[model samples]
Target: MSLLNEKVISSASEQTQAVLSFVRAWLRGEETFEIHTSGSTGAPKRIWLTRSQMEASAQATAAALGLEVGMNALVCLPVQYIAGRMMLVRGLVLGLNLIVVEPSSDPLAALPADLSVDFVSFVPLQMKTLLDVALVADDDQLSSEARARALAYRRRLEAMRAILVGGGPISPGLEAQIRQIAAPAYHTYGMTETATHVALRRLNGPQASDRFVPLPGVETGVDERGCLHVRGTMTGGALLQTNDLVALQPDGSFIWVGRWDNVINSGGVKVHVEQVEATIETLAAEQPELGLARRRFFIAGLPDERLGQRVVLVVEGAPLAEDQEAQLLRALIRALPRHHAPRHIQYIDRFAETPTGKIERSSTLKLLE
Candidate 1:
């Protein structure tokens, strides 16, 4: 048995037992087992996972990916999360040389240059930083130091059969940027409960913007509300219901809409926060000179004394004056609906984020208290 780090074995109470069972089955050639949820939906909970399921997943991945054994796979996400933990599993099961590094904005800095890595997985944030920096950080495309770093990354990327990207939304602008660079990127969709991604959407090359194709032996369908529901032996035949709203295409691929839980109720109208955020981000992206910026704002339904709920826009920055906020709201209303307009604008200095860089909405709202 490989030396499992203490961090790898512990999270919630059942995590240790789950990991131990997975190892026992792996050593016994049993194959499949259960993992845990990422808790993005509700709370982190245990789910059935198996080594055989993962092997089947790995085989399907290898066949689809053309991964060669002995090539290196860099693991940057935490092993506690299914995505990060599965990187090692996939590497070990597939005979790839696994290099583990602490999750950071700059994973390459912590690694040795001599060892060549063939594959890597990163969230959209990390990918954005890397690709964005390589493109805009320097005036010269081929400077001595810049060339060396780009060459290092390009070699590693080209050597890889595939690179899995997941954990958050991959914006259209970011996707275009990745495509422009010809990065071997695949956007993955699956929760921690599903043992990383059960579906893969290719985001680069000739097949850009392709629909997510389910892993072999996995079946998918949408509920009455159009939320995705997945069931597979890979997940121990558990029927997993997700809050993610999806548009099921006739072609068997589904397009993800905003989360059902992401909807905000203001007065009598229901507004999707994601759509509003995207609009705001689109407006911001029109400007090209906001170097290395972090913009996070969300719509919340504040408790109103008269109306059932009032619309509030919580952004991260210093508070604006009443007139300034009113002017901004008027500008925003031209693009958004009148009811969708934010009533109160609150400025928070910073956001509380998860280990994976996802903004913790509960924690962020708590600051208002």
Candidate 2:
């Protein structure tokens, strides 16, 4: 079972009916919550959050969007994450008819059949699933029921006001599909530490841009290494320094490159794993010869003892023939620096993923250990 199934969030009390009730009480002030981090990045810890802080964050969002009370929204993500938790708070505080549902592998399909959701937030995995399942066509050309279901899902998505997508990167192929279907998907950039997302990048339509525009009161700047730094309403207290490498545009926006930690060091050569992966994925699409046998792979450094760390390509699939592996390496060497290329290739049947369905690199490395 997924993490959502393992943990249950009980219904709120009468005092908790108001959206910001807990926050207001804590302010007037009734209470505080020991909010826990998702632990995807590092160790999970409980942090004390005052009611006023939460209210201030929510109000910032409302003010930024000029959202009035009683707007419709959907809370489809897990309540454990700050994103899902804040959705509930936003609904109550803004008086929106927030449609609550059990967190499922496919969130959009899990919604109540009767009500339509206006606003929604999804992680990359959920958004991909929505795109896939929403277009699920029945066998036999096109069955009426299948067609109806497809149309229904499409209409539901079309009726949505906005969709905030985060938790992980949505691949370019998937992003293109979302635009083709006209999904109002906005790629959000933030984490539990920053409440939710401090910046948003539209992923579809004519307005789509790779650059992330800061929300109200959120300032965008880069450190000496060009890493994004966030400070504003949702920051709670501390200034958030992210490991994500970014390019700050002159127009007050930023484009995410890759995580600085994701940079692979091989024989003094710095390589971006994401960059290599994107190239390989693109090659696989164009020429299926060097295709990834499965949905997962990783470029990790093994204790070479001599080189300190050597680039190793771990693919999740049945073992490839020696010649096939050699051919893939040759192709990679031509496309990347010799040091940046994998020194060895390993294969597995599947990859371990996080509760939110992100590729768990640390956990994946733990398998070799």
Candidate 3:
């Protein structure tokens, strides 16, 4: 990591100030706000949202999470995105005691020991850091006083009324860790268009679900292409279509598939990257001797003259030996459908990310060239 110089500090300060300014403007009766999309599916575009829409979203979220006014809530995500902005809206609409912190892997690390929050939101990475601390915060890293502070932070986290995780998928390994926590932790399913999460999946507990159950007053269905469409108060009752392919259940819940654009058709056989990725993850978890548990990999597609598009496995780390690659490929063929097997293997030092921290999948694949 590079040194945090005066200029860097100043820039970060300015960004935080910008977030504060946005909140203040909204409080002063600003009717509308503009923000950019993540562009995970296409080009980033600016869109406008009304203050009422934001308030409606907040109300729905509070009702779903059973949050009340005057409760303490921590805001830890980047202020530029919908996840972070909705945290501010929830504070404003519900009158929660919102604590803003510098976004980091552990946003609670530098806070005072006396703080206790009722609610808090985190992305998967932040949740992972908190879980790591709660699971094991060794005294070797600090003095007695510092160790006590770390324990206090852990306790504060374990005692939260409700915890929300959004912005990315939570792995099975992480879910297993969360299953041990006493507090209710939810994996949210929503995007910038819906303001925040429209559905919630309890990460742990007896009521955990593989399907995302929509919040009250939310209706769900699928389009012709098996893409999801949602209607609810947050969206002003206008049905919003999403690129995510889903298996919509009759009970209004749905199981998420991969992005519609990410489906790879090789030799007239279509393969969902998400299914292949899940299969690989499960295989790694079941077969520890394979050493795939420590490896980072994703399935993608590249143009092929004969096959239209050939499946590619992009792994992060050093180039593997040819025999090892062949062995992994053979295992994949056994685990996944034949059409879903990778036709090529690529290696990279690191995956590139967007400003908001999502993996730049397509751009990172170009690194292999």
Candidate 4:
């Protein structure tokens, strides 16, 4: 019997048929596959990836993380996207046992209590959700069953050889929680173009870092505008230019700054929206009473008659009271440069999100209209 005929695939839910479909195609030696980009920044588009390119990417990941054949790997992300597709490719190319589950905010919730997975990947939201449940405080109000489940999940997490977190940014608060877990977690940096992640940043332990180190065989450079340029086996020896601005390090590793397209020129001062969002997140972590950090928000530029584009803070949730909003504004103004401070705060019941769960800033802004 072939691997696809295994009990796992036969017993899988209908949601996991996509995983079975992809594996079947790979086993048949399909040469090219179509992948869709996560349109967090712009419109989503389709790109073609060769089987050789995906195999190379999978091999690089296996070597970087010391993955071996027969180890159980979990596939819990959307199969239509590259992150999830690459996870499937890695399993097929490396001869690993795959545990397929429908994508959710908490992928591990569906697993059996005794099941152990050696490798897994998650979006930031999923990672945060898992950590939140696993790290629930002892004294917190919760039923005995809930606490037991939390403990079980924590054990499952700690047993993993590697945990790859990508698809979005990991906030400071979430990073702190990740440190408490024993599992070796890494923040991956890459996109559909590079076949998931080309670089990774350690999220915990002594080796934890803010900079992303390129995997073996990958090269990094910056263009004149400071945007990142990637090349190596993953790109098939062709240089791939990205709009992501980064502070290139003396070594091959680099620190991701923000996107060039996300720059806001407010009254002549160029403000990076990511920097502003990061600052707010940090401030929220430092000063929890401000109530800014708990909410999901993004900085955007709106048309302005005088400044050409005015910076504004777009938040997801109910509107704050007059005094509370005022206090939040004061905190932001104190921490940010005068021009970087958001001129106004806009509230929406919910923010738009891409299929991969990234905040759709462009589409979310349209909600204000």
Q: What are the lDDT figures for the candidates, one per model?
A: 0.70, 0.70, 0.81, 0.87
Worst 10 residues of 2 by lDDT: 1-10
Report the C-alpha lDDT of model 2 over 1-369, residue by residue, as the tens digit: 011211122232221243334435433645466667766666567766555566666777676555666666766666656787778767756766666555665766655466666678887767777776566644356778777777777778777777888887777666766886665678888877777778889888888898998887788788888888988867765578998899899876899998888887766777787777766665555556776633567777777766767888888877777887778888888877668778588766677776655667777778766
Candidate topping lDDT? 4
Q: Per-residue lDDT of 234-308 in model 1, one digit per residue for the tens?
A: 566878898888877775577777788887776668877777776666654663232112566777777887767
What RMSD, rounded to one decimal, does every model reach? Answer: 4.9, 5.1, 4.7, 2.1
**lDDT (Cα, tens digit) per residue for candidate 3, span 279-348:** 8888878776555778788889888999999998888888777787777777888888777888578889
Tell me how candidate 2 scores on lDDT. Answer: 0.70
Candidate 4 C-alpha lDDT tens digits along 1-369: 124324444555654777768878888998999888989868999988889889899999999899999888888888889998998898888988787777889888777666788999988889989888889847368788888878888888999999999988888788999999888999999988888899999999888998999999999999999999999788888999999999999888999999999999988999998889888888888987776767898899999999999989888999988888888889899999899998699999999988877889888888889
Better of 1 and 2 by lDDT: 2
Q: What lDDT is reached at residue 239 by model 4?
A: 98
lDDT of 4: 0.87
> Against the true structure, candidate 3 has what lDDT?
0.81
Candidate 1 local lDDT, residue 336: 78
- By lDDT, the better pick of 1 and 4 is 4
Query: Model 2 Cα displacement at 337 (Å)?
Result: 5.2
How much does candidate 3 score in TM-score? Answer: 0.89
